[model samples]
Target: MARRPRLEPRETRAEATQAFLGRAADLAAEFAAGTPPRRIRSFSEAAPDDLRPALAILSEIPDLGLVVHGPRGCGVRAPGPAPLAVTDLDQRDTVLGSGEVLAETLRALDAACPVAAIAVLGSPVVAINSDDIRATVAALGPELGKPVVWVRTEGVRSAVPATGGDAAAEALLQLVETQNGPREPGLLNLLTSTRSPELAALAGQIEGLGWRVNILPAGARVAEIALAGRAEASLVLAPDLLGLFAEGLETRFGVTRLDVALPLGAQATVAVLRRVAALGRATGGGGPPAPPRPLSEPLAGRRLALALPTAWGLAAAELIGDLGGTVAVLSVPHLDRSHAAALGSLAERWPDLQIHVGEGQGFELAGLLRRTAPDLLLGAGDAVVVALRQGLPAAVLDPARLIGAAAPEVLTEAVDIALARWALVRGAVQNARPGYTPGWLKRSPDWHIKQEVR
Candidate 1:
């Protein structure tokens, strides 16, 4: 058996949280340094405030649509005025049951709209009654003969913004399964979840391989996902949401699953594609076609740093090592002492590798990076800043943008692209005159940033 590392001393929850936030601030400062790029206007912030912007974006996507439950102060904003359907749940309804109202809402939507799927964006008050709401929707789904997905968005406590995306993906998964015939003989479900636009690019890669890709939450409807069992296999690109849907596919359809690490560099990508091809062969499905040209080379002999969540760090480390890159430092937050010790032991196994545990945010992490400057950094969200400031290539693997409702393979492709871009940037920088700076590196104005709900 592999020996586990000793656990680090436990910090109080409050202390750990503070450390996490502090590190986030440092990271944010590093990456978000230019004029803010345009962002999709959120429904929560729109109308009665101008809902038109949100509506306009939604209108462009013909098949996909949004539904808001509860009255106006619910923070449920529809980007536009395509067709408004609101449910008013009172105190009595909250204490007793909102199922009747929800059922009525579903019936109305089924009758009036040609929606591919219905996403229930709940308010704080409505979130309190989520179970009742979901039961109502589930009951109404079969009755109305329409696929309804219930997303619980009550209380603004969590930092992640992809719950809506998760709900959307789950609904679409169900829809696809219901509508499609048993999974195509050798077909595989590509479990992609992420709010990032990179999903669009990744989908193209899988499709290029002549494989049928079922992008959870974004592209396909609920009926299509219900038919996922028919697919011969499932690939989990993101570790965070892997267990949930993978287990479901296994239980319902007897589909085999391959839990590969998210592909980043050239070696990792080839390894993943090869493994996927193997799974296809095992299931009697045709393997991916041979590449027209050779893929990029591995990052052997390079010094790499990783600043990411604990789950992603472990998986990434395995891939990084396989590529022949030397992992000089890893900055992870919230790891218990035993896990940290185990990680440390694993690092020791690698020649010249170093591992550090702490919140992703903090002066300590910055200090460590200053000491052991790495050639690359792989992390989610704000941690990309450290790499940027230190002049190293960095990839941001935001979980919100990587998992839940989007296509998992797309997320994998996005990571591959980010890695490719970083490699390109590094090559260009090396060729440039010493002390040359890129245009994006120029400083910009500092906009007042709002606090995200924790």
Candidate 2:
């Protein structure tokens, strides 16, 4: 990232599928060799596509008018701090084309609010109905005197939810299309969606180095987004929103993209800041780092299993090791080239770390949990439910908590709280309804992660 070279040009952000099953070491090796076993689950359950997250991400941008062209239940009544409208397409409208309805929604939303820019998020319903979303946006944008973009997010484009983030970033870039321009020295773009005290502090730390920091997209004005190309470098805090967005900025606007791991703990934060200083060529030294908050590693002398998203899971495992814990199994929704760097680093430290790949395939997770039987299970969303059904003590891995200065202490306290409830959970589920096949739990976790024979 410190190197001053233009990014390699890549055209499309399209993806077929993510990497298949293997050990962390093996996956890393194959990835490095450009032969990672990319496959599909033949008997996989129906999973969600990019629409949910894509709409969610776009809706986070403050004052950005958003219209999802589908039924009222398309993206649902997502409660957020952004203005969102829906086309409310009915059966007749779907058959007759909702171009008029879409234009009306856009014009109404544009007229009502002082949105910096407007985006039309296409859903599966509209894609199947073949609505002309782009033409509608193009016709209305000039009349309204504002940028209107169409973010394609059919529920079948990609299994990886982060692809939604890619679509969101592309829309953000398109909304703020700028001409080629010179960059400012020590100007860094800290890309994040949520605002937290920890991240605010981290940004302060960077600013202490006498450099300019521009927080973009989320909670940012259109002017800040326009200055994205002028930043000397870009650093993404949200892992899912990383690769495609940063790469696009570099490719289009000559910004440097720092490919660093998420700063989960104090050590990681320091390492990232140091990289930033070196890259940004800081003249005003920020001096040595301050001591982190005093707290013991709650998972010390304990072993645990991790079921999380790829980037966060891998980084959390490394941090867990630093805190004196062992990660026996690392289960993630999907793995791809974006994870190659973290995967390579993790494989070296935890060479024996068992890598479980599947997106919401709970049977495989149940089997792996039973096989390894770690003292605890750290997971997120539905994966945590799968663990608890087996009466295993588990804690939800909140991405927000696993970042910044408070992460170490926050995560430790969460583990302690979950650990205290172990006996209660174990006893309560003894008479619960059965959710898994006992025989399946005895089989290999990857039994269902079959090779793509086609």
Residues 1-454, model 2: lDDT tens digits: 1332321211123222443555778878877886454466656654656677676667667788889898888857335556888999999887777899999999899888889788888887875678877788789988998788878775366656667777787777775464335777778898886667777788888887767888866678766777888888898887665466787888988888887768888777877787777764555646656656544666788888887767788888887877788888888867766677888898998887888876767887787777778877887867778888877888787765677756777667767867888777777667777677777667766655655554
Cα error, residue 297 of model 2, in Å, equals 6.3
lDDT of each: 0.49, 0.74
lDDT per residue as tens, model 1, 97-159? 576676677667667877765655555566465545556666766776656655444444232
Global CA lDDT computed for model 2? 0.74
**Cα distance off (Å), candidate 2, residue 148:** 0.6
Total residue pair clashes for candidate 1: 42
Question: How far off is residue 413 in model 2, in Å?
Answer: 2.2
Query: Which candidate has the highest TM-score of all?
Result: 2
